[model samples]
Target chain A: MMGLHKKDLNLLLIVMVLALFAPFILNPFPTDSALAQFNAGYPDLMQRFVIFGIFAVGFNILFGLTGYLSFGHAAFLGIGSYSCVWMFKLLSYNVVPGILLSVVMAGIFSVAIGFISLRRSGIYFSILTLAFAQMSFAIAYSVLSNPAFNLTNGETGLQVYASDPQWLQSASAPNAPHLFGLPMRATETLTVGGWDFQFNVGYYMCAIIMILAFYLSIRIFRSPFGLMLRAVKSNQQRMIYTGLNTKPYTLAAFIISGMYAGLAGGLLSAMDPLAGAERMQWTASGEVVLMTILGGAGTLIGPVLGAGFIKYFENIFSKINDNILHQWFSALPDGLEDFLITIVHPFIGKGWHLTLGLMFMMVVIFLPGGLVEGGQRIGAMFKRKPKDTNGGLSAPATPAE
Target chain B: MGILEVKNVNKRFGGLQALGDVNLDIQENTVHAIIGPNGAGKSTLLNCLIGKLEPDTGSVTFDGQPVLGLKPHQINQLGISRVFQTPEIFSDLSVLENVLIPCFAKRDGSFRMNAIGTVGNETDVMSTAEKMLDDVNMLDKKDVLSGALSRGDKRRLEMAMCLVQEPKLLLLDEPTAGMARADTNNTIELLKEIKASRDITMVIIEHDMHVVFSLAQRITVLAQGRPLVEDTPEKIKGHPKVKEAYLGETAA
Candidate 1:
């Protein structure tokens, strides 16, 4: 009996159109131009856009709706990646089974972790999740990766070995994870005039999955279950008195989000065909948290935008080296150019994290609703009249619907 | 037996006895008001009925089912809903949403994964929530954020939230506690309207003599955590012990 509301349907349609034409939209710079380096139409970064979008969207379900900020979601992402790789090594090169197995494995992990962590709420809940993730990271980093065990393949990361069974495919089929005979790494570059756009198989696959994830998230946001989650955030004590058991609802959300991380991990390995223990690190968890917070925690489109913003900044800003700075400065007067380069030096190249931290601080301070709120403010400027008088509270949108 | 029965219910915090052998039998379909001074264990007894606290050694039953050891949600499921002194509506949700939550609790039980079903698409839920809001005269503010409403309106929304579940016994811990006189009178009128229409029994813990006189059929006066008298409102109005218990509160 459930269907999308008109507004929700419109949102889904808009996202779909944008994703379908992303190759053209993202490759605005011509191939001959110096700005082409900033063009993000390639397979690797494009795949990352949708994959991390999944990760952020899932994290939003737990943190945004429940107000239970988890600090260890990346453990699920790592477990997902490892599960996908083990599937490749044991089952076949087909991606369908890998994604399914990874989700199941992550669900199993989340059940164990969520069961223990959900015993507490607030900062205590966050700390319990952090402790669990740190433990997962430690085990994956050393104990599981040791030669005696070698479950994670240690510092070298995990990849499909030629010696493995790969029961569904012959050893000669291909080393990379694929969908039937279709290679996930395949891409076609289209050149018109001076513009070059990449149409990637893996990127499209990730885009489809991200779209599905977004749709499901939209449903959850509008569903009675999502209402309960917002209730948990708004007032847990009231909910208990209302006769709603919050623990199971929260655990279900945690598991669903964990599965989303698993799906993202599966997509990542499908494209790159590798898994590393570094994916389980606390910083990785922090990155997804940053994505959700930076986009707008509870909004449906906020997490995707946050993921794209962080990944795009990481890719484009980090590529600006000293040589490139000097070239730009050569056009300016000698002294001023040198001064500008020196000032901008720490925020680019290897210092993208410094830039990221500053942006996060500024966003947290001025635009606490993240990019979505910033977009709303700029949008309200054109409209010139306040849409609703009661948006004065910290809640920017109505639980994202 | 009355709908709610509390027999020799005792609760202690360390050496201080919060309630010592409290006994009360609240009749069905009647407005019962428990009037006492501050620290008379009114809220403590309310907590015991709602499963927020367990009595040290006694039985509290609602409709023949024991309620002392049940969890808060389970007690709620047992058809006992309490409205807090301060308005406890979901601040972040819209007014309609605040009402619809209890509708879900009534229809779907404690927990059900109705995640894929759009709230707008659920016609029965929408109508039930709409009717409840209309009853509270909050239909105009259905789309407004609950936290943005004034204190009086928040109290109305809280009442709507409780009423939507159609609980058998409604425990109100000073429903009109901090309201202005006009708002307090309005709340009394609302209570009278609800009492006339619904098949419900209300146990209101109140300090305001005006509200107690306006709505209560039977009154229980407690002083120092012990019941001083149980009688009709007219009799209790002239009782010496009841006057002394209140005079002490004013003098202190």
Candidate 2:
């Protein structure tokens, strides 16, 4: 009663089922089949889904409920990665300390940023956060990379160094990052009939973390703190007048969201033990925004769904080459085959971003509430939802439901 | 002793004196109205009292606590709530949530991180908000978005949000500013009902003579950033200064 509503419990069950069976669901293409190239059961891509899901879920907490569009959340992500990597370099290959430190470090950083940026609202808040993030990027690029510090390692990227002291690590232990003796790189491949499902340890770890993150987000969404954030979004004018010091509530949400991004970043390093200044760029921050909006903001499941959808498009769409296109249209007549390839060329491989942009545009225009709203709209139509003309008052409406 | 004491309050905006030496003792549990013609510093004085604008040199004390340097929320925590000229309900939240915001603030103060605690199951908060909504006759439509509410309903929702806090002083700035006469009457009835049921003091800045005369026990007339007169509503209606400064040519 204090945590999940019945509906939210159902959502959690659905997500758990999906995540538990994704290896099978995503590997539908049989081994050695022509479509095998499209198989997303690989560990790398699955890990990305859960990781970015964490990122988007965190972003949604700030942007969705509070309507504070932070254009620099990726700075926290980059900082998380850097902190995690530093943990790996100085301590050992264990991910526990790295992940813990990442969240804590991101929390500290966000508190400072939130205290400063939350003084302004609307586009000004966005600009302030963006400027702080850009400054962080610059510091990571040059200042921190200098011989006096060299914290970020500049453009070369920071990674585990064999020469560095790993005091807690046993010489007998595997050099890669791991939980105790279980390496994140371990994979268990199952072959049934012609299909092959590969379940990787890293994916499961990320999946478990993502589920916890989602659960925390759902709790926050339904919490009193969350209601305050939504009130802040709805009308700061009313909020201030209602005796609510809105700044602290917003700052708390911002820091929590930043910690979410940090968790995502920590997981990134945990899975692949690397950190780069480019990870903190504004484009990365924009990606999380796109993921949240494209999936549907303010909904419990939207951010994760959005994260998976975008990652799926990025991975699958970017893998299709001209040769694959020719193969797809080979049976057609020469003129038609050539024409189709020409038309489809710009939207595949290097042009996958173009397809993504168009899809996002369509989503924004036709489905303002994003994919979750679309699902609800369909559900509402089928369920014959009652039209709310309460007391026969003609009221303006939107996806407020 | 007065619940609210405004002493030597002066506010200036650039070269224009918005309020000059404004002093008033707002008694407990009384519906007091401050009426004036346009540009008569009524709104400015209200702003100073609510901590929106600080007086150049003066003090505002609510329940004898200095409120001059306090933030808006801090002042609110001292039991002061204001309803704007236009309805200022949380437009994006559901009707129930608009009322719940203040309940949370009332219980938890201005800032809290009880992020994991559920709102609906807080039985205490839910029942309080529901009771307030019921009082405002909006219990049935609590799930509707506040933005979608009719003008009269929005006003009702705002009143519910304010009164739910059960502040010691309620500040209403032109509560019926944009309403039709029918809606204005409805608001008047609602305000009367609210006042009769609770021992709450109210400070209202108004332009409507009808509303002022109908509800106010005592009226203060402000003219050109100065208090023209303060007296019983009946006495103020016949006062020559009020007639000259406000009623103008209609000095009967």
Candidate 3:
């Protein structure tokens, strides 16, 4: 285990290889089948997996490493999306401008929020972020409402037209310009025997950016700054007494996380060509928090795994209905079929959230380390010898214990 | 000139007066110990000097500059470091990583936004951190999680962290407060070794008279919120006021 954690160089290599080949493994299901909803190989969903993965990864830098939980990260994401759309309207439809603006705007916003929020730590910090998020949501809904649509288009959201100028138009020459000139064309199609794969070019773009974000995050996690962050998390008073300033380090982390959220938001608008104030809602921010917690807080791969897990289950579970349940029950015995349907009905359709809530609760209660620990436990069980099984590998070795 | 001078510092918290007209001057390259009973405001005074708390009155100066209202890091940049009574350390970080933080702060000042450079590649910072860890005899446990260390080792790591900054003045609150008898002796020896090698001035707040006598060149005793006496360690040990304030009827 020491060797495994000591050399994180191999960890990124493994993740990169897996991400590169994920499309092939994920594309195995039939397009019309229920399993297809679980297929993250599709361009739209794949883009989401990577982009949201970036968002959660950034958030983990602040929440996971430093133990400072912010509930308003989605506001940064919304700022990114809106800025991207605005770029699409004023300048080129290229994603570069949008991404740049998103980062700048999010950084500015975070500085203001961090200055105030950082005055209080722990639960107060969390509350401050939540309050800020809610305030932004309300302002986006009211001031940017339709009657005076100066900022956002209110509930209608901001949309880009195909007639937008092509600054970096070469990227989208054959294809129509996406928000800020990002090419939305389906660029590649692979055929293997009787199977065909249609790849959206935008997904690859998102993937490349995600890889860059991952690299930067890895560097930050290993830096002296990262050590100070962990120090602040463990004991702020000790850090101060050590003659070190923790405020600036934490504020930097907060801003960096905000920029990641902005980038994710920019990508979202680029893919869909629309930005809504609803994206900045506290609930949306809470979703990423859930993703980070459910996956594993501090580990690198944990956030991505958590993002994919929540997105996949959300896509698959919400689509199921009473009719779908009845069809499955029809294959069973008459009496048992009705009973199974009754028991499973609430967990499908609109009740999908109930299932997710229960899963979140169970994970938090039983596996506080999240899915990362869950995977480790399974690996330990298989590797344990019969005689050593009673002591289980998960049990920490220590003098005090 | 004295490295640190506190002139008539007074601190009040609601109805309580933590420090009442406290005054002290610490010369360069000497150990000054503050011995007091509980609630004598030693910790409060330390906090005030380090900028964790601001005294209602009086001023603090370090290296001939006033340091009354500066932030802790600002005071640190002016060459003062502190070690808390509790063994405060980054539990999740490796022992070496904890030490490297102060080295980075001292080298780069308060902030350096070099997001791309790997922390391990900073050879100077790493070497300095390693040297400090070696000084504290924690070089062997460099890769271990700091939280896993024994109490004595944790205190040693914190000292190494402070030392890496090369501060002119060091403030230690209860350096041997919770240590075993053997650990307490080890700490005193470590302090002596540090003093022999550097021109560092120290202010130690301790309860153990043996540790105090072994390390302090000068000792100041406090009762209530005021300083009762200040003298050489030998005289302090024999002072009737100090004995009466601390040893009670048993010493008589």
* Predicted structure with the largest DockQ when compared to the true one: 2
Q: Give the better candidate number (1 or 2) by lDDT.
A: 2
Instruction: State the lDDT at A106 in candidate 3.
Output: 86
Cα-based RMSD of candidate 3: 4.1
Query: What are the per-residue Cα lDDT tens digits for candidate 1 across B134-196?
Result: 988988778887888889889889988998899999999999988899999999999899889
Interface RMSD of each: 2.4, 2.7, 4.6
Q: Between the candidate structures 2 and 3, which one is better when assessed by TM-score?
A: 2
DockQ, prediction 1:
0.63
Error (Å) of candidate 1 at residue A120 is 0.8
Root-mean-square deviation of each candidate, in angstroms?
A: 2.1, 1.8, 4.1
Off by over 4 Å in 3: A1-7, A32-37, A161-176, A179-182, A187-196, A380-401, B14-16, B247-252
> Ten-residue segment with the worst summed lDDT in candidate 3 chain B?
B111-120
Q: How close is candidate 1 to the true structure, as a TM-score?
A: 0.97
* TM-score-based ranking: 2, 1, 3
What CAPRI-style quality would you assign to candidate 3?
acceptable
Candidate 3 on A1-401: residue-level lDDT in tens?
21123446566666676566557766876666655545557777777888888899899989977899999999999999998888877766666787789889988999999889998999999999999988988887777665545678788888866765645555544444353343675557687764446677787777777877877777777666776777788887767666667888899999999999989998888787789989999889999999999998987777877887888777778888888877767879978988998999999878888889999999999988889879878877899645643223222321100
Instruction: Provide the TM-score for each candidate, comma-separated.
Output: 0.97, 0.97, 0.91
